[model samples]
Target: MTTSPTAPAYIHVLIVDDHQMVIEGVKTLLQGEADIQVAAQASNGPEALRLLPLYPEISVAILDLNMPQMSGVELSRAIHATYPQIRILALSMFHDYSSVTEVLEAGGSGYLLKNTNKAELCAAIRQVAAGHTFFSQEVGTTLLANLVIPANFDRTRDAHPAELTGREREVLQLIAREYSNSHIAKALFISERTVETHRKNILTKTNSKSVVGLIQYALRYKLIL
Candidate 1:
């Protein structure tokens, strides 16, 4: 018997920002990706909510945190409540820990700075669409420097790299160094599949969604020199 072809994963995204120029810029950046499509665009939070129902294929929403009328935080919560299946990725110029925490707590699946590069932004959207979180490296570092860890917190037992195994830490450090999966696999004498498995495990163990977050945790707790 002949098997049917697998369906392609839909990665429709909605861009919500107050500025048309920002929307246009993001659209231009995303134009090269075949798998990712801009399902809709909105200038404000209310318009975003209105447009969302029309784009049922939108798996992710890229939101600007400083939009007028409805902020990204509020939009994130509304999206989470109304369309819990759609993941929210917050975009902003703010580098403060409070802003990042606010977005995440408001149900954002990932966060990126406005100045993020094209590759990182696209990667972040895909990651969040796949039910994983992502954060820009700069944002991660800022959060690490400003975030307050409780005095009672133990790195070994806490939600950071302290919970990771030695092998996982090695993988994380490689990740921090910007090593690709193939490179990591080759360096560690492991298969690419195994490397990917280690990556996922590290993310879960550290409660981190991206390499940036993992690296920040490592630096914050002195897990690596």
Candidate 2:
């Protein structure tokens, strides 16, 4: 009996962002490639978390830092902690020296800016999935030029954990995005009662009296975008 031909392996990817248009654009770009597939798209970190379990073949995650629930940095940390084998590609607008450093330090293998072309983005996914580091060309030039600063290196070495949990930061970011508790719960796939619990804990941890105060704290500390 003749056997059927095997399909080529495709690099499964997850796109994590809060914006619909960005997701659609990336979907189109990835779909055109024969060896790649947009396995899943998430609107926020919490939603991403829920979707990740279903995509066992997902090889890379393209993350956006400015989501309503969890920022990219926190999501990177969580992914590294849980599914250590999955590669993370931080897709962000912060191609600045500090931002790139933050993503790499947080366990991301690739960093690309929003304006990167479709070819470069696909190349990046393949590169990172194969255990190579990739940075956007524009960001790479700046990064190479600035990598020699002694002070910058020292500051990166001195980084510390924020005195907040990932879930708490997720709540704070949703607040910054002007999402209500009910909305946050819906987006996060948690019940309203659970969201309220997280909110109370976030307020206590940040010492913020209310939602407005929480936003002020986040912006002052440069935690939320």
Candidate 3:
């Protein structure tokens, strides 16, 4: 059976980017779609905050890093705290573990590379709006490879042992050593699907939105180290 595209009752979106060209281009594309509407545009994080409360129907917010006055991560945290319902999608050029981790830690629902195709960008927005986390293939690949955090913060492991179950910890050690899920599962005598399930549980218990965060949590508390 062919499924129909879900039409939002009303889609109010806010685009926060520094370049005029990007803002207009995204607006042109989204506003032309059937039900999605470009409700507002902001050049920087400050403007995004000022505009957000005014546009209550905003289902998704696409944010760009390197904006003046405030970085996207800073703005994302504020919005997440106050407007928990709005899905935050980060569009940025930095693809390394550190950069993606910041957005995830700030509570973004998804992360996309700036070079992501228009179709994938649109799909990511819809995915987040439907409450499923989304990530670019590049981002996801890198996430599984590296995870690092500042030297200070306590991992608060006591608050989240479910993520670091004995089996998960074993898997995480191999992951920290940069082993692929397949390799880890085979070496550990488990199926890849079981490995994936453990990975999912780790993310859930640690409140990690991505594989990188899962690794960071694993490393921080010495589970992987």
Candidate 4:
């Protein structure tokens, strides 16, 4: 007589937004998910910080970019510094690179536009809780659109594009399209570690500094349209 395996614990979430309606709407959307629970809600950054102590089970925080006194970026930075274990997922109406990048630099694990559907919101929460990054398709598109190339930039000065293998090119295209490593792995039928290795190799071969640089490289070499 052996006991059955234990069930996985639910991912506890804390929703922080200045608008009460938005918070309620998010809670309603998450209510039907069996593996996710809305543990708490806050109307602002200070309130969120105050409530954090009371809800230690919260593993993910959905933050709004704009708030009255403390912006989501500031709140994210504060929460990350104090509660590094809690992952932050930013939900914003703004899809611009500045807002998205600010939240990310402030320790957000993911970013989703306010127009995100129930499925994406839940997926983002789950991914962030599991220590993975997630971004909405629209956000990814915006990031690609905003990649700036210098006026005098010369591709010849960088690593030769021919050095990338076929698999490396595919990985670069997906990365330019803003697909997360997990999504790329699933699409390519490879392990996440393999996808990561491809990414590192691509970066090295292209002599790219960041995701933006990779996208720029892909654009210049026509690796991705």
Candidate 5:
């Protein structure tokens, strides 16, 4: 008789925020998820850095954008520069495009507003931990609203738009329309994993480094029009 396969291990996470209440709240929300475990909590970037060595199993970090001494952007940059393996998720009250862009540019794997519900927050954490980008519904909409696409934008800088598979096109359009992976997965009747795969493929074919870049490419090529 053969033994059954072992279940996958939980992804350890570190929560970093200046506010003790915020950290506790996030920890509470994450309590019921069997696939996730909170390994530590830090009040600031330096504390987080210090705790990293103590908990080397942490695969994801949920960070607050505003903190004393070192802001979330600074912390994210520092963590990314030193520990490239830890994925970051920025949780902030700000929904502005600039703040979101800064977090992403700072090497955050995902961004979600502080008002996010527990379910969405958990989903975002899992998505980032699994190596995919996640943007809250409002955050994505705000980002698209701030973009200014030129009427005569050229698409010849990259490969032909036709090179994208049909699935990739659908995923790209939904992403431009500000749909999160879970939403796209539901709408397209596919798994969130499949949507993530399509997103990575789309980025590769378009040579886009971020979601903002991908949206610009879509507009230039009329993929969203």
Candidate 6:
């Protein structure tokens, strides 16, 4: 008799924020997700750090940006330095370029606005947990508006345009436009798995570390306006 295939492991998460209400809100939003678990919670950076060692199964950390003792950026940096395996997803009210950039620079894998709905929040957590990046639409817009490519940059010389297939290019364009995988799949009349494959190929061809990098690449190559 053949044994059944093993199920995928749960995506354990750690929620960190100074405000108890915010933590409770996140937990409530995540209650319906069967595959995602709130493995632990902490009110500050130090508490979060202390809890990490205890919960070795935690794969993601949702951090609030403006905590008193240690800011989200600082916590992100510290967590990245020590627990590189734990992907960080920053939650903040501010959609400004500086705040978003700070989280990315500090090694955060995703950024979500505090006002994000349950669907987007869960999607972002899953994306970051899978070693991919996600950002709120407003945050993406802010990044695109502020990120300036060099005036003298040569796309023909610098970008590997020849490496990307036509389908990959299409995916990249939609991605720069902030379309989700499901939306991209629907638009292209392809399965989400196919879209994901194209996404991976696009990132590999462009050497993009995250969505931010992919957007910058698109801008540099004039793939999107």
Tens-digit lDDT string for candidate 4 (108-185): 778898898899998888776765567788877776677665565566664445478878877775665445688788
Q: Candidate 6, after superposition: displacement of residue 111 in Å?
A: 0.3
Rank all candidate structures by their lDDT, best first, as comma-separated numbers: 6, 5, 4, 1, 3, 2
Q: Candidate 5: TM-score?
A: 0.70
Model 3 alpha-carbon miss at residue 134, Å: 1.0
How do the residues 92-197 of candidate 2 rate in per-residue lDDT, one tens digit apiece? Answer: 8767777776676666767899888889998888876765456777766665555332332334432532377777776666654435577778767788998899
If scored against the real structure, what TM-score would every candidate get? Answer: 0.68, 0.62, 0.64, 0.68, 0.70, 0.70
Which of the two, 4 or 5, has more lDDT? 5
lDDT digits (tens) for residues 1-225 of candidate 5:
112112236889999999999999999998889899999999999999999999989989999999999999999999987887688999999988789878867778788988888899988877777655678888777766776544544656543564887777777766754456887888788899999999998887776767877764665566763
As for candidate 5, its clashing pairs are none
Query: Which tens-of-lDDT digit does each residue in 50-82 have in candidate 6?
Result: 999999999899999999899999999999889
Candidate 3 is scored at a TM of 0.64
Q: Which scores higher on lDDT, 4 or 6?
A: 6
Instruction: List ranges where model 4 is wrong by over 4 Å.
Output: 1-8, 148-225
Model 3 residue 63 lDDT score: 94
Judged by lDDT, which candidate is best? 6
> Residue 62's C-alpha lDDT in candidate 2?
95
Query: Quick one: how many clashes does candidate 5 have?
Result: 0
Off by over 4 Å in 6: 1-8, 153-215, 218-225
List the global CA lDDT of all models: 0.77, 0.73, 0.73, 0.79, 0.79, 0.81
In candidate 4 the C-alpha lDDT for residue 202 amounts to: 82
TM-score for candidate 4: 0.68
Superposition error at 37 for model 3 (Å):
1.1
Cand. 4 Cα-lDDT:
0.79
Clashes of each: 0, 0, 0, 0, 0, 0
